[model samples]
Target: MYGLVDREALLAKVRAQMHDKRYRHTLGVAESARRLAERFGADPDKAELAGYLHDYCKCWPVEKMRDILVRHDMPRELLEGEKELWHAFAGAIVIQTELGVSDPEILQAVRYHTTGRPGMSLLEKVVCVADYIEPNRDFPGVEMIRALAEQDLDEALACALGGTIQHLIEKRKTVYPLTLLAYNDLVSRRDAQGGV
Candidate 1:
């Protein structure tokens, strides 16, 4: 559906939209997403595209993001919740309405990059895990997650989600419902598969 989307131009736009550090991270995510998609037998090109635009609205002002969120009629809870989550929600709308991206997979990949939902697609899983394990990212368990990502997408995502939840709990931060739902769904799937 998005055959007319210009990948290079979109990349350039994304690069221009972000600061140097964030742009570097975006590049790292795109490369990581491409590699993960290749490993998982998904479309590397689409993964790269999604990764590049996933944080398109990260640099936008809070006021502008709030406006976009209202314009799109996003979940009232999201609008009333953490300001940090606005980027992912607003980025998806901006990607479609402003950037002219029409593909559902790409949009979903951007939309759920922050608070992932249950039953994510391969592309969504690839983007989420790639964002967590991007080369520039250096967290406590990043290496382990990166290794897990190289081996198993589902396991990598489950670990990332679990880690995020644990960190939030440790810091006494709000746990978005979707994040908990995604973690539970991954755990359930793993249980069903008799894998750990």
Candidate 2:
């Protein structure tokens, strides 16, 4: 149960901080998160909050994000990796230090929104999957993920994670180890339960 977080003010801050296209994506993620929460029986309000704030630092200058990474002592390996990954890790720190969000669940959701970790909480899975399937994410296999999400959250997330890994491999891009760990955990869980 999260306390009051001033949704209106948070939305305005997100609107001001992000560009129009990013803001629209954030809104879509929020709506998708809410829907996923409802389907999975998570707290929709909290999921929406996490979605709205997930990209809080997406538009920040590279220098500022790098500074946050330095301040937070992010691994040098990650620092040398994709610039896009900075937003999730740095956004988690920024929301706590700047936006005064102290809720651990919300913080964890923001922290792991990009490279999901093993043993994710329900809320975390909801945010990650919602982000992947948010409307406007026009990638191959998105519709299958959307349909799978409706039927089973874990299976949908495993599929989404697998898709991400495949995409990264095809592009010869860096693959975050934590994502692999998460995918392995999800796949194991689904298999243990006889697949979802």
Candidate 3:
């Protein structure tokens, strides 16, 4: 039953803690979230709030993130390997416990914004896709994904997941198994329905 936190206060805290680059990314995400919310018929305020706070815990030290997860008794399987990616779940906890946000939709949106999962809610998909295809994102082929986002969310998600998987492979980084599963799930769902 918690209500949305004060947006300005939340942004202030994030700005105080994050470096300029990270803060810019936050702003980009907020804009992207608002845009996607409009496109998908979601609440723009909630989308902006969720997107702005999606990375609240991203700036925390790795040890602090680990401690938060450990104290919450987060499943070890989810915590194992890819310690860098633990911030998303930890951020979910922070959003609920610290920010007084109780909405499952918003929490899930923040939780999966990084790695994403199957059967994501509309809000979740918006935040996830926004984070990936935000206008300020200048990675290779981002324009293509942005176009897909404008036209078809599912296709955009598929492309983003494929790109992420490929990038991880190229960097020799450990690809989270959930990411691959999410990609396949989206692809399968899209194909089964004749596209989304």
State the lDDT of candidate 1 residue by residue for 137-181, as single tens digits. Answer: 999999989999989999999999999999999988888899999
Clashing pairs in 3: none
Name the regions of candidate 3 deviating beyond 4 angstroms: 1-5
The C-alpha local distance difference test score for the whole of candidate 2 amounts to: 0.91
- TM-score winner between 2 and 3, please give it: 2
Regions of model 1 farther than 4 Å from truth: 1-6
lDDT digits (tens) for residues 35-136 of candidate 2: 999989999988999999999999999899999999899989679988878999999999999999898998999989888999999999999999999997
Quickly count the clashes in candidate 2. 0
Clashing pairs in 1: none
Q: Write the per-residue lDDT of candidate 3 for residues 1-196, one digit (tens) a residue.
A: 1144655677787797678888898899989999998998888878888888898888889899999999999877777868767889999999799878898889988888888788877888888899998777899989999999998887888899899999989999888877888899899998899874
TM-score of each: 0.95, 0.95, 0.93
lDDT agreement with native, every candidate: 0.91, 0.91, 0.86
